[model samples]
Target: GVLPLAGLGAWVAGAGPVVLPLVIACFGLVAWGLHRRRARADCGETKIHKEGVKP
Candidate 1:
């Protein structure tokens, strides 16, 4: 989880200050992907419901 990653990053920070941005970017990408997937799923469900399909 992010907590463990945060702790590890804190330790790593003592050596350098580059991993933080990489970690943040990775989380941002993951969040964006999940949001897009959910939006697509909702759109599909709406279409199915509108068509009277019992989903």
Candidate 2:
């Protein structure tokens, strides 16, 4: 949230025009990766439970 806000502020402040977009893109990619990782972890847990694994 801070990073995104910084990016927006920088753009509004007229700091390079490319800065905001790049920051947004990077933030999005990171968020997406994290989400995918969480989904995979959940799936793995479900599979383990289905297999009757004691954990």
Candidate 3:
């Protein structure tokens, strides 16, 4: 979950060039998105139950 944030910190701290951290952050974002989707599905929150309401 903290991968992207850590990568951003690394980049800001000058740990390496911007390219590498950006690549890592991109991958981290994808991974976090997948994880969040799976979690939402597990919680039965993948769809809206009605107008102005979420499930």
Candidate 4:
């Protein structure tokens, strides 16, 4: 929440050019991490579901 507020403040302060890419990158990283975590969970707990699914 604070992170979003800080980014919003930065945008309001005319720092979009610099902050936008960083915010986008951060969201990308978070999404990637979440996907990896879910994939790992599926791989661990669902052998039938993970059959033939290569890493």
Candidate 5:
């Protein structure tokens, strides 16, 4: 997320002040998405592995 946003900012501002906020926002969104995914998995969600593996 941050990677793409920083790219956008750099394209827009050419390595100026706007890049920082864009990078921060991108990072925040990615972090939030990861946190949400983790939370969902923790609350009794079952994941299936490959067939050869024993559970």
Candidate 6:
């Protein structure tokens, strides 16, 4: 949210085309971090449909 808002502000301030790409990259990083955390929580398996899956 902050990254996108800052990017928008930069674009409004005439920082040119770099703002959107930067914002997108920031969002991607955030999403990747979340995905990694979730993967770690499931022991890197990415799917845990059974109740006895946890060690």
What lDDT does the true structure give each of the candidates?
Answer: 0.86, 0.85, 0.76, 0.82, 0.75, 0.76
Instruction: List runs of model 1 lying over 4 Å from the truth.
Output: 1-9, 53-55
For candidate 4, the TM-score is 0.61
State the lDDT of candidate 5 residue by residue for 1-55, as single tens digits. 7999787766858766767688789989999999998988765344333433555
Candidate 1: minimum summed lDDT over ten consecutive residues — where? 14-23
Note the clash tally of each candidate.
0, 0, 0, 0, 0, 0
Better of 3 and 5 by TM-score: 5
Clashing pairs in 4: none
Question: On residues 1-55, what C-alpha lDDT tens digit does candidate 1 reach at each position?
Answer: 7999798867778657676678789989999999999999999999988888654
Residue pairs clashing, model 2: none
| Candidates, ranked, TM-score | 1, 2, 4, 5, 6, 3
Per-residue lDDT tens digits for candidate 4, residues 1-55, read 6999897776756975777788789999999999999999888778865675755
Candidate 6 Cα misplacement greater than 4 A, ranges = 1-16, 44-55
Candidate 2 C-alpha lDDT tens digits along 1-55:
6999897686656966657678779889999999999999999999989889764
Q: Please identify which of the two predictions, 3 or 4, would achieve the higher lDDT against the true structure.
A: 4
How well is each residue in 19-46 modelled by candidate 3, as lDDT tens digits? Answer: 7768779989999999999998866753
Ranking by lDDT: 1, 2, 4, 6, 3, 5
What CA root-mean-square deviation does each model show from the true structure?
Answer: 3.5, 4.2, 8.1, 6.5, 6.8, 5.5
Give the CA lDDT, 0 to 100, for residue 8 in model 3. 71
- The TM-score between candidate 2 and the true structure equals 0.66
TM-score winner? 1
| TM-scores of all predicted structures | 0.70, 0.66, 0.48, 0.61, 0.53, 0.51
Index of the highest-lDDT prediction? 1
Candidate 5 Cα misplacement greater than 4 A, ranges: 1-14, 46-55
